[model samples]
Target: MKNHLKSIVLLVLTSVVIFSCSSDSDSSKSANQFTIEGQSYTLIPDNALLELKMDNHIMDQGQTYDRSSITLSGLNGTTIGTASFDLFYKDGLPVEGTYTITGSLSDNDPDFFDQLLVDNKLCLGWTSSCAVSEAGAPTFLVNANNPTGTVTVINNGNSNYTIQFNGNYRKYDGNFEVIGTSPVVINVTTDVTIQVF
Candidate 1:
């Protein structure tokens, strides 16, 4: 009876270990999921891209600033979004400072569905006015009009940068003329750093 009891205890311990490992694995997968406006989405990290461009120019008032353009793409080469802003610099180059870029989606712009590319394919069809606002120098904010949220970008210097989308909200049409919200969080360490020069 003693030996039988020992065997049963060992079996129970083994089962517990297995269960713990499986639970951990499942939780790890869930970590990749994010809820925006109550809708959950699994971010495809491999399909993200970001590009930045800088141009120095003098205004009519003889003030010099750097005109910067940022473009974000996902699911492939589809342009998810773009922003343009001017930054004042003392030496014809943008100093390490926080800058803001704001723009609105016009009727001539591409459809929002075409912009949201996932795995080299379009996700869903959405049409709405989206205003983008982003800042630089540490903590950043990428917010839009319809569905509002923040996006963070980190510049590691040497033209290397990282882009993160956190709880970004977007508005879309649901069934029966109902409007819905979709929030997304995507953190991607791009293979190629966005070069700003």
Candidate 2:
């Protein structure tokens, strides 16, 4: 009878531990995020999209390249912001690795996916006409152009991913003019379910 009771207690304790572990794992899966300059935006799965364009372009006589682009958008109160990146792959889809985000791509190198491009933006409301303030209806727009950064993409399998970006981005206004003399420091980490196309 004592052995039977011990077995029951052991089963209950094991079940509790398993349940706790499952809850912790689920909690670790955070919402996707887009950070630009110094502001952070939380993007839901529905608002975030990752498109894989196979055979997007051809170069080097007849070599085909695939393009993977991710667009993350979210709204903070009345303001809306977006962050996006484009990565080119020589063969197929991009695997788990760290990619350089740069404006320059060399035709001599066959590895086109090694270098990538990133763009970011922040605005007021869903439309361009949305007013931030009544004082002359000023709008805030920023872009990361000719950016130099590193983005680490980890494929968690089954279209799930965790991407981390740390880099210096050139800030450009809506008129495509450099905003400040110094580049903007942007760091973003997001866990998302990529929608492949």
Candidate 3:
């Protein structure tokens, strides 16, 4: 009877261990329901390149969006303006992030990578290459000087994003504002979808 009881105890312990392990293993699935159709991504460059609405370029960028850098933006306190973003595959999951740009110095003419790094290197300069600020916000070129502040990633689809550069600034074009504030912060929301075959 003791042996039988001992066997029963061992069985119970094994089952408990298995249940414990299974519970822990199941937690991995508790994450958000992130799905990728296959391996395709939609990308929008924050630069004038996207402004032109060139079909060919957009197609090309999407083909290799994961490897390339593209513009990305989000609303500040308020939320308006659209910042283009690139979505790609990482570790079997679709990931998206912003591209850091240094605009060219001269408005008259620009060289390759025309935008020079800001003195602080936080923001890109004003130029053809540097993506323009939201349609109307007050924005000029990098002014041939590095931006003082750095831009940060407010949020990420995957990990809890930490702040990064401070440049991709908000040029007020007199768009939207807070209820009471004169020229409140711009609120932005952009959603990019990726379809993989």
Candidate number of the best lDDT: 2
lDDT of 3 at 116: 19
Superposed on all Cα atoms, the candidates' RMSDs to the truth, in angstroms, are 13.6, 10.3, 15.0
| TM-score, one value per model | 0.36, 0.55, 0.23
| Pairwise lDDT winner, candidates 1 and 2 | 2
Report the C-alpha lDDT of model 1 over 1-197, residue by residue, as the tens digit: 99999999999999999998888774554444433343333433643333444444423233333433333333212212322122223334333333222222431234421232211111111221222222233432233333233344556676544545444344334332424434555443444334567
lDDT of 2: 0.48
By lDDT, the candidates rank as: 2, 1, 3
Give one clash count per candidate, in the order shown.
3, 0, 31
Lowest lDDT sum, 10 consecutive residues, model 2, at 122-131
Candidate 1 segments whose C-alpha is farther than 4 A from its true place? 1-47, 54-62, 74-150, 170-180, 193-197
Q: Rank the candidates by TM-score, best first.
A: 2, 1, 3
Task: Report the C-alpha lDDT of model 3 over 125-189, residue by residue, as the tens digit.
Answer: 33212222334557632111222233333444532332233233333234422122111111222
- Model 1 error, position 63 (Å): 3.6
Candidate 1: deviation at residue 80, Å?
9.3
Tens digits of per-residue lDDT for model 2, 1-197: 99999999999999999998887652343334455555555555454545444344534445455555654555444456555555555544454566555444332343332232122211111111111112233654553444555555677766566666555455556775757522332233345544455
For each candidate in the order shown, give its overall lDDT on alpha carbons.
0.38, 0.48, 0.29
lDDT of 3: 0.29
